[model samples]
Target: MSDALVILGAAGIVIPVFARFRITPVIGFILVGLLVGPYGLGRMVYNHEWLTWVTITDPERLAPFAEFGIVLLLFTIGLELSFNRLWTMRKLVFGLGALELLVISTLLGASLSMLGQYWTGALGLGLALALSSTALVLPIAGTHTPVGRAALSMLLFEDIAIVPIIFILGALAPYADAEGLDGLFDTLWLGAVVVIGMMVIGRFALPRLFAQAAQTKSPELFLAASLLVVIGASLATGVVGLSPIVGALVAGLLIAETEYHSEVEGIMEPFKGLALGIFLITVGMGIDLTMIWANLGTITAAVVGVLLLKAVVTGVLLRLMGARRSTATETGILMASPSETTLIVLAAATDALLIQPGTAQFWQIVTAIGLTITPLLAMLGRNLGRRVEPVPEIEEPESGEPPVIIVGCGRVGRLVAQMLTRHGKPYIAVDSDADMIETCKREGYRAVFGNAARMDALDKLGVDRAPAVILTMDEPVLAQRITRKLRAAYPHLPIIARARDSLHAAELYRAGASTAVPETLESSLQLSEAVLVDLGVPMGPVIASIHEKRDEYRERIREGGALEHKPKLRTSTAESAAVQAG
Candidate 1:
């Protein structure tokens, strides 16, 4: 299929850049798509009409793939939403998220209406203004700062709000010029109906479905069930006059409390990645460089306006919510990019006939422009982050000794600490997790309670004297943030981070980590080999051969650097295992 070929071509370009640049592959995909799209260099070879024709490129047919990207992406987000985590920031996630959506929406709407734009367009723009790029934010979250996670939580909250926003946009369609309480209530009712119906169905069917799937004990079957839950629930929501993505999100929420949650997520991970890849390429294909150039003033105005508003709002909210000054500012700057959700709102407006083609296209051009400048913005964030005041130093009490400060007392961190302890190495453990710190204390390990990325925590852990800071947070993004902070503050303190995967490891390296260990994969491979040997395969030669190939592969990967091999993850051993098990 031409659609498949397009995606492949885009991936071919993006994969290399992702490996070398430490940039999000989604950005690369978009760039590739733009170059090959009708609005850019591709227009020289094929016109828009040809690209859209079902007999030719069939662009419309890929809409569902784009839609799937949204649904699964949201679904993946929902899986991270636990009651405990929500309660940790009930005030922020609920209050701040709500305030952000309401305040920003109102301001943008009013601004657009004052500019002589139609109320429908104003409403669409209002919703669009509230969104930040999840794709962009995720890679940053991999940086591992408390600010990054806090920013991410806020973005997640915004994502959740998009469901209602879409409904509101749909209601605006029938009476294009009207703004009334009745219309608002009508949209709310539709949203309520969809939510209620899903809650009922999900509460009843999801458990039973997952329970049945578990009996099969086949990862393929589990994956099938996961995809069904996402696509089926999303489609069902679409039938009820809501965005299918919202439906999938609700579905994920419904199953969030279930025992099968982890299993479902594991099965869906690869599909989510592939779907995301396709979506990025599709988004890239839509970028109109000529239009962006022609309307530079308007596009620049829109981008600057949105970024400034979001930055101010986020900074004020975080400060008000008791976050540190550095955290407040970083959170704001890090989340200012317009991403897929913004465009999704714009596209939905077009579908509802709420915005004219020209207006919709205008917003699209602005969005693409914003996306185009995101990498530069990220570089700014990284550069600015290094300038933050360093933590005050203390003399090294243990001179010339290899000191390790394990930031998290979680499973991984504790294990790393214990390993060092067994080797008679001096180390200290710090954790924000109260229970973890208490457990470590009871176990006779030197531990303290404080946010590891916080200056106070680093000082408490004696970071200035530490020769190596071992950050083993459960979250990779959190680890990356700490790594970056440590690099900036304690330049000589070597940071050895634990990455969730190779992609994550590379990001950590970019964040200035001296070393990274993919513990999960390392353990998983060894375990899998053991299992294979138990199942009657010759383990000795097979594993040795596999290790030899793996070494060659990693050597090549290192030669290519981080950006080059980023998109070709499919060709890696990790991807092979995915095919075998997932």
Candidate 2:
């Protein structure tokens, strides 16, 4: 009950307050954990009833939830990545990522050995610290930017390597002898069989399962199905002595092959984020304030030393792989922290008798602290990235001729751009969809990423000096708002708006649009014209009749202004003239 209350409190209070301050919720959750966990206030009030409600007596109790968070994070990562994109990133994912792990682990292992640690212990720690947090890095930096791509490619390889690393650690166990080697080989064989079995089974099963869930139109059912697949796969792998995360990754990849990945990702986002926060809090709980106070200098030195070494190593490797200096620097800094996986490895090492409990506990604290400040590192890296990276050039046309400013880049917007292009008009299309922008760019269209509603984004598109502003986004309210704002700011600029219906067209006109093209009206006209032409009517008459009917509809729509409670049009001589002008 206390744990649930604390989690709820963090979600309801701490997260919102952080968001209000424009600060990251990542830091807020960590600080909340530090304040409540056993090492902090929980220690002072271990037996209290009311006061204990706010404290976490056992962080380990919440470990499964934290682990679930990582599983969801990986699942979403897979959703964002397609097989085609993954195939293209194979070199980076396999070649560069593999090299980075091998080189860094080897270097760190050698350094530990030189410092008089056992070779086994050194190797264990090296492999552990060599991995960076996919769970942290993915959310902080995302999977879109150059840094994100680099981080993801590397993280994917690390997730895959976890089982092998554990096997090697087992082989290094104190008295395993030949049995350990046999077990390692057996584990590998079993893991391969499980992975293949899953691939075959999931390929046949998942789509049907999700399709049925989707057919039910119950979000609860869909979400249940998603959780079932993730837990089932993770459990299957864990039972075979492989890291459960491997199964999670495989489940994600399998789901990614189906069209339902986006829906699954959307439904699971809140769970993923909350679970991730829980994970971060658990990390904070691991930090013993008393231990740090007693050995402040040592703990601080270890934290700084690990961060600096990892950053330098990662940055240099990225640079060698042809990343821009800024991108490499930023990514390296962002990835400096030891992963949550490092804690897992450290614990396993203790179990395998590869490292002492004291040593494991010390590094676990360090890893926790490292995880705590990862978001901060990401922020610092962004600021440094700007200083190192060159400013992006503007995509505006030459001679300062204000291009046609398109507010949306959907089907209607794309058609508008195509028409403008046919007329040799220089225009720029702005859209909120990255996929739409990507698709447009691939097909040799001029599109830039921005929300039509944002003033800053519009300013970049040169909305003030544009020849005309076209609002082609299907959102009626958004179109009206943009139309009114533009009309108030640029009175002389022509605003062409698309409407859902004639009533919406009238609303747009009153909102100061020069012309409002209602999709409902146009589609009807097109259909009528097509029917007439197919029924043996001459093309000219069919077109003329369609145009006349369109003019009549527009006039009626124009007079049915938004100045009244309902759309009202007065029939007058001037209105009839306007309708007949075509």
Which candidate has the top score in lDDT? 2
lDDT of 1 by residue, 353-446 (tens): 8778898788777776666666666666554543452322323335457468887887778788779878878787788876467567756677
Predicted candidate 2 versus true structure: per-residue lDDT over 182-236, tens digit per residue: 8778888899999999989999999999999999999999999999999999899
TM of each candidate vs. truth: 0.64, 0.79
Clashes of each: 14, 0
Best by TM-score: 2
Name the TM-score of candidate 2: 0.79
What local distance difference test score does each model get? 0.71, 0.85
User: In lDDT terms, how accurate is model 1?
Assistant: 0.71
Q: Estimate the Cα RMSD of every predicted model relative to the unseen true structure.
A: 13.4, 6.7
